[model samples]
Structures are given as structure tokens and as C-alpha cells.
Target: MSALDAKKIAEAEALMGQVDSAPDEYAKAGMYFKAATAYRLAKSSDKSKDCFLKAIDCYENNKSWFHAAKSYEQIILLAKENGTLSEVEEYANRACSLYQQHGSPEAAAAALDKAAKMTESKHPELALEFYKRALAVVLIGDATHQASEFASKVSRILVKLKRYEEASKALKKEISLNLQTKSYGQVGRLVVALVLVQLAYGDLADAKKTFKKWGNRCEHQEVSTLQKLLQAFDDGDQELAAKVLASPFIRHMDVEYALLSKNISMPQCIQNGI
Candidate 1:
């Protein structure tokens, strides 16, 4: 390292020594936090993470939950920058829980949402759990927009995981929230999505039941086309199903239609051994 770098590292080490010898909980927490910043300036990421965590522990011991949450949030950001996704998830969740304990449900939900997004690409199941936590926190705070958004996210993840039943359940929660908020537009979309989930699971009866319950509220052309698609699947008419799947209305449903169309086509592909 250069002379200036060495000098900075030594200064950081000295600050860390003071942290270790601090006489009281508050002072120790402050010192550890300062040392963590010093370690970052010295380009020692591992040491920075360690000192931050030590500060978090001290804050927690002293019932300084807000400070602890901030420390965990910093760790999460550092882990993200370092591309340590597992650490990012861990510290984000910790930050979320601490924010919750500190009586900040909005902050908790935001933290959990960040954790969910971080894990979604690499660990969908874990991401689902984080989204659920976020949903719960937002629901508690009556943050309608966040609650609806997180519920939709959870349903999408569950569907991607091929947990169609759970996906339907999550969609139902989203639908309920939309209904409460009188978000008629979103409710219509979620109803279509629910039907798609049911169809993907081969729950034709439930799909029809769901359609009967909520399809009436949707646009006439869209509802009629989806019904025809469902009917084609029920009749095992591959040509008709294919035609219905290709319709502009179904195409507009995007991923939901893709999932249902794929499921409906799978049996025919297997039978024809193609």
C-alpha cells in the first residue's frame, strides 16, 4: 500500500482499539460506527462489515433499535456493492425487523422489499418469503399501495415457482386489497390472472368458478375471449385452443396467458409425442 494508505489504515486500527476499550455501551456503539467508516476509508471491506456489525450489536444491547437498523441498512448497502447477495439479504432482513421493532412499519416494508428484489433473480423462494414479510408490514400500516404492489409481486413469484395454488391465494389477497381500495381496474386484471393461475394448475372447475365470480366485472371482449379459451381447453380441441391462445386479448395478458397457454398445450404435446 502507499504511504498515505498505510497511514489511514493505522489511524483506523487505533480507532478500533478505542472502540474495543470503550467504557460504556453508547460510547462503544459510537466508536464502532466511526471505526466502521474508517475501515471503509482504508479500503478494508471485511473489517468495515465487522465493525458495523459490532456497532449494531452494541446499539441493540442498549435498546437503540433505530441506530441498529441504520447500521444494518449500511451493511446491506455495502454487501450489495460488494456483490455479496446472501449478506445483502441477511442484513436487509435484519434491518427490516429492527425497523419494525422500532415502530416504523413503512421503513420495515421498504427494507423487506429491497431484500426481496435482491434475492428474486438468484433465490426466488427466499424472495417470496421476503415479499410476504413486506406485505405483512405494509398491511399493518395500512399502506394500501405498497400492500397491493407487494401482494402482486408475491403472486408473480409464486407463479414463477410453479406453486400455482399458492399463487392463486396470493392473487386473491391482492384482489381483496384492490377491492377494498376500489381499484376496479386492478381487480379486473387480478381476476384474469387468478383464472390463469387456476388454469395453469389444471383446476378447470375452479377456473370457471373464478371466471363466473369476477369475469363479469371485466371488459366484455376480454372476458368473452378468455371464456372461449377456457372452453377450448375443456373440450380438448387443440386447434381451437391454439387459435384462442393467439387472440389479441389473450396476448395482452402477457405472462399470465403464456403460463396458461403453455399448460394447456403440454398435454397435447405429450400425447403427440412431439
Candidate 2:
């Protein structure tokens, strides 16, 4: 009846003609995509899906996630799948979100990672959403230390987003949850984060105190809590430096210290012995 509607029908008919006449699968796929677009414009979701499914089948056979994701979104919208999708994000991210909603976090995280690497800084907000979704799925139904470890990773991304307040809150929540359950490794991680946040805010004394409270509890020597202690010292916090050196966490640093001392002592010993 309307010019726009008629135009769309004409386009759909033309695409259908191509679909019927196309000699090869690729050509048929392209025609189906075009017909699907026209059907979508005409509010014919079922017809759109019919054509889109053909397009998607071809795309999947070709191993093209980009186009497959677009077609899958149409399928998802027509009650074929349950999930959320935002076309404004990257193609892989759309697929990732849908996969996450369908309870496949690992698959979702993988897709999100691919999209994140390709997007660069162009879509930080979308990237943050993917990271949050990954954390949520990883943490779900798990009361163990791994959940807290995942929380730390999520907090790291939040800090990158300059969401410092949220990062602090996340760290505090992780600490409280793990400490209540006696998840010492997680508590250590939280305390270390708290110390870093304090140092970021220029509260050297508090950072030093927090580190002292947590340094030896989780056997944090593997990660070298001394690295952070040295940072405090480098920042001219002499009292913090003294406290850190006296702390048990630094005891493990003896090997590194000895190596340095040996290098210096070796030269002198060699000079004298020679």
C-alpha cells in the first residue's frame, strides 16, 4: 500500500529471484541475506528467519563467525534462542553475550577476548561489560577460593577503567567473603590490592600496615610482596621501608639479596685473592 513497503517487497522479490536462480551456495547465501534484510524491513520475522538460516548455514560452513553471529542474532530475536544482544558492540561480543546467557561462560569469555583484542580502546565500555560477564560466570555456583581469585581479576579490569571506588569495594567484599571462609590465599590477594589502592591514594602508612597484616598469611613470597614494599621505599616512605624489611615477607627476599651481595663481594674477593 505504502511506497516504502512496496519498495521493500520489490527488493525481497528480486532477492528471492536471485536465490532461485543462483548456481552456487555462496551466491545463494548472499541472495538469502538480502532477502532476509528486506523481510526484516517488512516486519516478516518468520520469513526473515527462513532466509537468514540459509545464510547462517552457509556462513558456518565457511567458518565465518562474523556473519554467523549476525544471522544468529536474528534467530535469537525470533524466539529461537534466549539471550541479550547489542549490535552496537562487535560481532564476536554479540555472540559472546548470547553464549553467556545460555550458560556457556568459557565460550563467551573466549569470544569476548577475541573481540577485545580487535577493538583496542575503541570500545572500552563494551570491553568492560564482557569482562564483567566473564567474572560473573566464573564466580557463579563456586564458593571456593577460585571465585575470589576471579574477583581479583575482575577488580584489575575495573581499576583499568578508572573505576577506583568500585575496585576498592570489590577488594573489600572479596576480603570479607574469603576471610570469613578462611580462604587465606584470597585474603592475601585482597590485602595486597588494598595496599596498592592505599598507595595509589598516597596513604603510605596505611598501605604498609595492610601489607604487614597480610604478608606472611598467604605465603605471598611467591609473588614477592617485597616488590610493593620496595615501591613504598622508592616513594620516600622510610618508616614503611623499615617495617617492610623487618617483616617475614622479606625473609624470602634473602636469596635475591644474597645474589646481589655475592656479586659485589665476589669482585672484591677476587681482587684481594688475586
Candidate 3:
């Protein structure tokens, strides 16, 4: 490290010591916040995160949840820069929780959503968890539309991860949320996704059942199409299934399902001449 940076970090630690001995929590919060900034100037992100956390403790002790949440969010940014992969989720989760306690559920969800988008490419499973947590945060209020929106995000990540079973479950949850708000059109769209996921998961029986579950909800629009598609797969008719997959409904679905359509094939047992 540069000599200047070393000096700045040392000064930051001294500020921390002063905060520890301070009798007034408000003053401690201010000192810790300054120390956090000093450590950041020193290019010592780990130390910066610690100081922000200390600031959060003091702010929360003074019933300053908004300030505490803002400070905790600084730790999230520092963690993204220097903390371990595991630490990223931990810090983000705690930061969102603090925002929730501050009566800012939307802020909490938005923070996690940003973190998830940033992490999705390199750490999709963790990104999926973040999206799920965001959905939970949104569901804490009566914001049914927001809940449905986040739930769809959760399902999309699960699909991108190729966790078809989990994707089906997530889609089902999203459908339920939409139903609660009488969002029939949204439910219809998710119905197609759910059946597709069930099919991709190689659960023909469940696929049939799921299609039937939404038959009335979808105004029976997808019934015959799903039936023909599912039947083609059932009979191990790859050509027919491939043709069915080419329908505009499959082609125009979400990007994830659209990609899945291109890759769908009969199981190896059938391909291997079983």
C-alpha cells in the first residue's frame, strides 16, 4: 500500500477507537461514518465496511433506522468490491433488512434487485436467492402487483439456472400471487410458463395436471396446443414435438423459455432406442 494510504488507514483506526469510548451514541455514529469514509479513501474497503457497520450499530441504538440502513448499504457496496462471495449476500441481506426496519420496503427490494442483477452472471444461484428475498420483502405489504413482478423475476432466474423443478415452483407461486389480485391475464401468461417448466422437467403427468389446473383460467387458449405438444412428447415423437415447439406461443414466450424451446428434446432413453 502507498504510504499516504497507510497513514489514512491508521488515522481511520484512531477515529474508531475514539468512537468506542464516546458516551453519546449520536456522536459515535458521526465518528464511525467519518472513519468509514477515511478508510475508503485509504483504499481499505474491508476496514471501511467494518466502520460502516459500527456506525449502523450506533445509529440503530439511537432509533435512527433510516441512517442505519444507509450506513449498512455502504457495507454492501464495499463488500461487492472486496468482501468474499459469501459476504456479498450476507451484507446485502442485512442491508435490506435494515431498510425494511426503516419502513422502506421498496428501497429494500430495489437494493437487492440491483445486487442480484450485478451478481446474476457470475453467481446466478446467489442472484436467484437475492431475487427471492426481494420478492419476500415486496410481499410484506399489500402490494400485490409488485409481489407478482418480483415473483416473476425469481422464476426467471430459476429458469436461467436450469433448475426446472424450482422454476416450476417459482412460477406456481407467481401464479398464486397474480390470482390473489385477479390478474387473469398475468395468470394466463404464467400458466404457459408453468406448463412449459413442468414439461421441461420431464414430468408429463404433472405437466398435464398443471395445464388442466389453469385450463379455465387461461380461457382454454393453451389447452389444445399443450395437449398436442405434450402428446407428441409422450409418444416420443421428436419431429412432432419439435414442430409443436415452433408455434408462435413457444417462440414468443420469455427469452428463457424461447431458448428452452430450441433445446427441448426427448429423453436419452428414447434417443438411445429404448
Candidate 4:
């Protein structure tokens, strides 16, 4: 280990000694937690986990939630008694959920973030499970901003799951939440995403409708540009298409053009219409 790591281990051992002899339960718990932190810094998570568990025991025995939260957070890191991968995964998830029930939205969000990352690489199903779990806690918790943030994340996970319909629905829900919260920037972003998802599902008519709805709600340059472009495309008017191609609407046409470009063949109707 590096000198810094060795020093942290030494400090943790010292704190553990103090925790062993402290008369006050709160003080003992705090010391144990400190020891765990130091051990964690030293890259000794296995050894550090014991100190955290001890801190949890101490805090719970004293009914000190403030410290209990800190200890539970560390216990989640340890995850299991013997630390099997799946066992630890379940333990962390359950413990984090319990923390959320106790009115800790931030804690729950943090744990869910970790869970999402863990499941993303090795098991997407597991990632989605954690994403849903996090979504449940965020919706129930009092952290509106955090909840909205997690909602955005859940939308991404659903997309990864190839549940395109569900992803579109989730995106729409997030847009509504942002509207209700008066988070104009978030609403703008989600509206764009919603449009893209709709377009992805070949629901051009619905996408057009939603684009119009959002255009009326927003005065953003980007939104205006998108509305014009979508209207132009829907109209199949050469003049409107020419206008869009020459205007800011070009950027807004990217998603549509990207998809359609790949499979584009001149429509017989367009030839007939002209």
C-alpha cells in the first residue's frame, strides 16, 4: 500500500481502539464510523466493514438515527456478512430502501445510483430492477428535485431495456413533472426526448401533436425551431421544407432525418401530389 493508505489504516486502528473504550454510546459509535471511513480510505473494505457494522450496532442500541444513517450507509458498502456479490447486492438494496422509508430521499437516491451502475455493466435486468426501486423511493420521498433527477435516469434504463413504449411513457411523465414543478429547462429537455421517443416508435402523428403542444407552452428558440420543422415535414410542402432546411429548424430535423434517411425512397404519393 502507499504511505497514504498505510497512514489511513493506522488512523482507523487508532479510532477502533478509542471506540472500544468510549463510555458514551454516541461517542463510541462515531469513533467506530470514523474507523470504518479510515479503513475504507486504506482500501481495506473488508476489514473496514466490521467497524461500520459495530457502529450500526452501537447507534441502534443508543437509538441515535443521525449516526445510524452514516453507519447503515457503510454497512451497505460491506453488503453481506461474508460479502457474497449477490448477497451484498440484495443487502445494499434492502438497507437503502429502509433508509428511504425513514424519510431519506438523498440517501435512497445515492444508493440507487450505485445500484444502477452496478447492474448496468453485468446485468441490465438487475440495473432496471434497481432503477425501479430507486424510482419508487424518489416518488415517495420529499425530495422533488432528486425525484425528478431519478425519473430521468429511470427513463434511460427503460430505453436500455428496449422497452421503447415504456420509455416514451416515462419520458412523457418526466416532462409533466417538470412542467408541474416549473422547471422550464428540464421540461424543455424532456419534451425533446419525448418527441424523439415518439418518432422512434414510428408515431409521427403523435410526435407532431406533442411537438405542437410543447411549442404553445414554450417560447424557446429551440422549441420554436423544432415546431416549425415538424410542421413542415408533416405538411409535405416543398416551400415549408425549403424554409426549414434554410432556417434554425435544420437542427430540429436531425432525429427525424437520421431515421428516415436510412430507409428513404421517394414516396409515390409525393410524386402524385407534386
lDDT leader? 3
lDDT of 4 at 19: 68
Clashes of each: 0, 0, 0, 0
TM-score of each: 0.86, 0.44, 0.81, 0.65
Candidate that scores best on TM-score: 1
Q: State the lDDT at 59 in candidate 4.
A: 79
Candidate 1 on 1-274: residue-level lDDT in tens? 7776677678778887787578888789998888887777767789989989899989999999989999988787777777888777678778988998999998898888877887788889888998998998898898997799999899988888888899888988988898888888877767777877877776777878888888866777768777786777677767876787676666677574466655645256433534
The superposed Cα distance between candidate 1 and the true structure at residue 266, in angstroms, equals 6.8
Compose the digit string of candidate 4's lDDT tens values, residues 1-274. 8999999999998887776589888889889888888988787878787888788778778866545665665665565333444644664565575565566776766776775675566566777677677777777765566667767777876665556678788877777777777788667656666665665565667877777777566547657666765665565654654554455433444343333323323234533554
Q: Of 1 and 2, which scores higher on TM-score?
A: 1
Candidate 2: residue 36 lDDT (0-100): 86
C-alpha displacement of 246 in model 2, angstroms? 17
**Model 3, span 1-274: residue lDDT tens:** 9998999988898997887688899889999999998998898887787888888889989988778877866776676667455667876887788888889999899888878876888898889889888888888777789889889888998888888998888888999998998888877767777877887877777877887787678755566677788788777788888888888878888898788777667786654546
* CA shift of 13, model 1, Å: 2.8
Per-residue lDDT for 248 in model 4? Answer: 40
- Off-target runs (Cα >4 Å) in candidate 1 are 2-11, 20-24, 254-260, 266-274
Which run of 10 residues does model 1 get worst, by summed lDDT? 265-274
**CA displacement after TM-score superposition, residue 151 of candidate 1 (Å):** 0.4
User: What pairs collide in candidate 3?
Assistant: none
